[model samples]
Target: MWNKLFVDHPRTVQESYGEHAVMAASFGGRMVLAGLACLVHAVVPGLFVRTGSRTITVLYDEMVVNRNRKANKAAGEVAAVGGR
Candidate 1:
C-alpha cells in the first residue's frame, strides 16, 4: 500500500520518490507564479504581456520532451539488456 501510494507513480516516471517530489513541487511553483502573472496582466495589459503565456509554453514543452526522453531511455536500456 505504501509503495502504491508513493513509489509506483514516481518509478513509472523514471524518478525516485524524493526526486519526483522535488520536481513536482518545482512545476507547481512555476505554475503558481505564472498564474499570478496572468492575473496581474489581466488587470494591467501593458505589463507582462508575454510572460505568463511564454511560461506555459515552456512548461508544457518541458513535460512532453521529458516524458519522451524517459521513455526512449528506458527502451534503450531494455534493448541493451536483451542484446547481451
Candidate 2:
C-alpha cells in the first residue's frame, strides 16, 4: 500500500509523514490490528483473531484435512495447474 504513494514522487524520509495524514492513519490502524492479533494469540492457541477465537482446526477441518497426504498432494497439483 505504501508502495503506491512513492511510485513517482518519492517522499523525503525526514518530511514524508508531515505531508500525509492518511498514511499516518493507515500505519496507526495497521499497528493496532497487529497488536490486537498478538494479544489474541497470547491468550488463545491456534485461534484466529479475525475469526473471533475460532480454532483453525475447526475452521478447516484440520483434524481430517491435514492427515490425508494424498488429498493435500492432489490439492497442490490442482492449484499449480489452475495458476493459483
Most accurate candidate by TM-score: 1
Q: What's the residue-level lDDT of 78 in candidate 1?
A: 100
Mark the regions of model 1 whose C-alpha exceeds 4 Å error after superposition: none
Instruction: Assess the local accuracy of residue 26 in candidate 2 as a C-alpha lDDT between 0 and 100.
Output: 56
TM-score for candidate 1: 0.89
RMSD of 1: 1.2
lDDT of 2 by residue, 6-74 (tens): 533324322245444554565566556666776787799575455433433243453355346546676
Q: What is the C-alpha lDDT of each candidate?
A: 0.93, 0.54
Tens-digit lDDT string for candidate 1 (1-84): 999999899998999999899989999999999899989999999988998889989999998998999999999999999999
**Alpha carbon deviation, residue 24, candidate 2 (Å):** 1.4
What global local distance difference test value does model 1 have?
0.93
